[model samples]
Target: MGYVVPVRANISSINFHWQSLVRRPMPYEISFRWNDPEAMDEPRANVSYVGYVPRVESVFSVLFPCTGRVSAVVSVDIMLNITTYQPKQAIIFLKLKRSKTCLQGQPTPLNEAANDTVRLVLGGAEQDLSLVLGVTGAIGVTFVTLGGVMMFYVRQRKAALRYTALLSCWSLEPEQRPQPCDLLGWMQDLSASFDRLI
Candidate 1:
């Protein structure tokens, strides 16, 4: 039973054992009680890490030739989000009951239905705000420094090209040199590129 539903939380991986008992119509009530339940609100349905027990439904749906009860020890992996603010452990309570209704349309519990509890120990929060902030600041500084160095290198390259072009024009005979209009246009284009870099 490795199946699990996705949840929204900074949850580290966790592995635990769970059991399922099916007497009649299978339905169960599951509740998680934090050691300090008063501090936290009840988990909403959307964020609750709830999942179905795999293969239990299909196996239990069949009618048997002889009457008997079925029980199984299931391995379930549930991802629960723990925080620095919460307790280190929790108790999971389960109540197995019948989902079938009576003649009066009221649901009833099975006589042999049982309850179970599993102790879950959660590791402490592995990171804090300072670690995150430190990493972020280091990355920011690295990018800024790299950008500055790149800009300086580009400026140097452009200056070298400008100087080489001017020296080439000076070395050429006056009549062979570029037309003033062409030189002006080229200067304007270089200025435009410089402006873009700025």
Candidate 2:
């Protein structure tokens, strides 16, 4: 049978075998993993690498599918901050995991899907970095400055103290916390936390 995919789908419902039909996405890194009950906090794909986009050509890739009941599409969508300079690589990868047991498993994509899915898409998009930055960045800057002023009025907000509280509850041995974080980028104040951690 043939799988008809939309131009863009939610990053949560991706499958590995659909690589061929996938539209070339943002030039982002990709990795895949099987579900794992033991290490819910760590990435099970055990694969990590950077992606480079010479020309954002049409994208296609075929891999195994998810074995477990729930499906997830792990992706990174970055709109570049610089004009004229494109990202190195941008694509999404499907990682498989079991929802109930949280165990990791891998299923292969069908042959036809595999054959049709892996090409990169390239060309200039009608994106206005200036507008995005001007609007979103302006809002962020306003809130941050306002927040700083508010912080002055309120009690001290100690990030170190709060993060310590989180680490204190996390088990060294794996157990599924209702919301486990496999993606470090998805963690709470991860960027700032990293600054504190190191």
Query: Over the full model, what C-alpha lDDT does candidate 1 score relative to the true structure?
Result: 0.38
Tens-digit lDDT track of model 1 for 82-171: 222222233333322211111222112222221222333222223334556879999999999999999898888788777787788879
Where does the lowest 10-residue lDDT sum fall in candidate 2?
Answer: 75-84
**lDDT tens digits, residue span 139-193, model 2:** 9999999999877644334555545645754744456432555535335465465
Candidate 2 is scored at a TM of 0.23
Give the number of the best model, judged by TM-score: 1
Cα error, residue 163 of model 2, in Å, equals 82
